[model samples]
Target: MEPTTLTTDRLLLRPFEAKDVDAVHAACQDPEILRWIPVPEPYGREDAEEFVLRAAPGGWREDTMYSFGAFTKSGVLVGSMGLVRLAGLGGLERQAELGFWTAKEQRGRGYTVEAGRAVSDWAFTALGVERLEWVAEVGNEGSRAVAQRLGFVMEGIQRARIVQRGIRRDARIAALLPTDWERTMETPYLPARTD
Candidate 1:
């Protein structure tokens, strides 16, 4: 269950490669990345190495998650996104959580949305997931905007449901159902201007 390659009009979502560790390390070192994600602070090369070697592979094989390295046609790792927290009852496992982050230099280009849209499609059609859940720190408007653009309906804020850097934080919860996805269709929104 190695993460497979996914594509959209201007992006390619693929599995992390050994060479991507440096880029991953660089992205993780961003304070915003450390702030929103539950990863170790002062993110270093070792942390990114371990993530690529252990957590990511295990996640994909368990069918519990899939993390992709977001690259451009020329193959530069600009970011990463994942379907995580997958769980279900009986033989049903149709729900998952979505999480992503872009490099500091690439923040405003809608790469997250493009990658997310690609994965959401795979999750629903290829993986048989029925619902995709999203949550972001209450004031993380950037992330919330991506969720909205991906058609995840805001379900509301969860009081102190997220703990970051030893502080309790509120999270905006949202979900996208297969019914809300246009299966036979590709993404319709043009990439928002980065400038």
Candidate 2:
């Protein structure tokens, strides 16, 4: 799939470009972002360059990960969002993992939530994604909050399911189905009964 763009009322969601390297590099410097996100410790400009100029586009070309850099209307870098194909989506299955990181200064303003909604919509409708899962290392409250606001039902903790900084850790998992947003899809979902 070719790289695409999404526009919200206040932001432009698109692939990271050369000009965005500085902002991405700077944002990764925040202790909070570094603590949770699996970015390089002591992130360097070269690392940012490799991510923007190479790995990001590579994901698009491979049709495995769809990533977007969220920016304000005036072009301030807000954050990054992505969907990694977990299963299916290649032949007959439809599942993906949703991930994101909000810049330190851009937190609490609802930008990541806005971008997440748009991205999720595209994944469900455009990519035919049946299950969009959000997994954050346990205790990442900020990330979990954004997923909830986007209507991802909290599922539960996954034991030793996440590897961060070379160690396995538990994760909080959640998901959003098309029906959560009243969007009808070809694949019918019969969720297990609460009782």
Candidate 3:
């Protein structure tokens, strides 16, 4: 899974580069981003360097996660989105977990949703992903809103599903299937009938 770029009407989702360190560090300083995003509380320049130089690239090289930094056409960093925990991409149960965080100033412009659609479509086609899941710690209305807008069906909640700063927290779970996007799957899904 080599790092690649995905484009939208207004965005260019690409792998993080060395120049993104400052912007990434600055964005993570937002209180809201720190609260909901699981980034280090006191995110520093070194951390940003690690992400841009190491972690993100390493994920792609290992085929474990695919991360993209969402930017405007004019090159403004708007957010970060990634598909982690890629499992069974070579098998029938292929799946991945979607995660993202928007810059505080760029919150309402629908960039995240646009980027999500691009990633989801890629996963379904290029990666053969059957299901894409989005999980947010409970109370993250913003994330939930984006997930809903991306057409992920609300599957319910998971108790103690995530640990943030070592504290257990409940999480809202949702999924987007190939059928949700009108993409045909090799193995058809049969939903249970409600009596």
Candidate 4:
């Protein structure tokens, strides 16, 4: 499956390219990013290249993941977002796991929320997914805020669901079904900027 491009009011959510290594490395190097994600303590350019090159494309081929580079209108690499483990429990591919991260400088700008909403919209409408699930570490307040802003209902907390960097961590689970999106009209999402 080819990675698809999605758009929101101010974001161009597209697939990562080989040339994105530097920006990806920079994004992954942020202390907050390394703290939350299961990346090496000091993310190197090789890791970024391998992720954008090997892991990303392989996941697409296996129908396991869909990652997108979040860009602003002026083509700035502000972040990344994706769906992982996009398969069903009983051979029905209707569910997926959602994850996202933004550059340090891009935080508090609603970019992830906007891009995540766009990804959710595309997953439901274009990919025909029935539900999108989100899980973040218990203390990941930023991610939680984005999930809430995108209208995901917090289901509950799962004790030690995430094993990040060899450490067990609790997670908060949230979900959004297609019907839920259709029913909610005002989800507090930012309008995409066209300029």
Using TM-score as the measure, the top candidate is 3
- Global Cα lDDT for candidate 2: 0.91
Which clashing pairs does model 4 show?
A: 9-192, 9-193, 10-192
Please list the C-alpha lDDT of all candidates, in the order they appear: 0.83, 0.91, 0.93, 0.85
Better of 3 and 4 by TM-score: 3
Candidate 2 lands at a TM-score of: 0.96
Model 1, span 1-195: residue lDDT tens: 656999898898987878888889988988888878889887888999999877788788887678899998898777889888887612365678999988888878888898998898888787777768999999888889999999999989999999998999999999997777755322233436989
Candidate 4 worst ten-residue window by lDDT: 182-191
- Please count the clashing residue pairs in each candidate, in the order shown: 0, 1, 0, 3
**What RMSD does each model have against the real structure?**
7.1, 1.1, 0.9, 7.7
lDDT of 1: 0.83
lDDT of 2 by residue, 55-139 (tens): 8999999887888999999999999998985578855678999999999899999999999999999998888888899999999
Poorly placed runs, candidate 1 (over 4 Å): 183-195
Clashing pairs in 1: none
Ranking by TM-score: 3, 2, 4, 1
Poorly placed runs, candidate 2 (over 4 Å): none
Model 3: lowest-lDDT 10 consecutive positions: 180-189
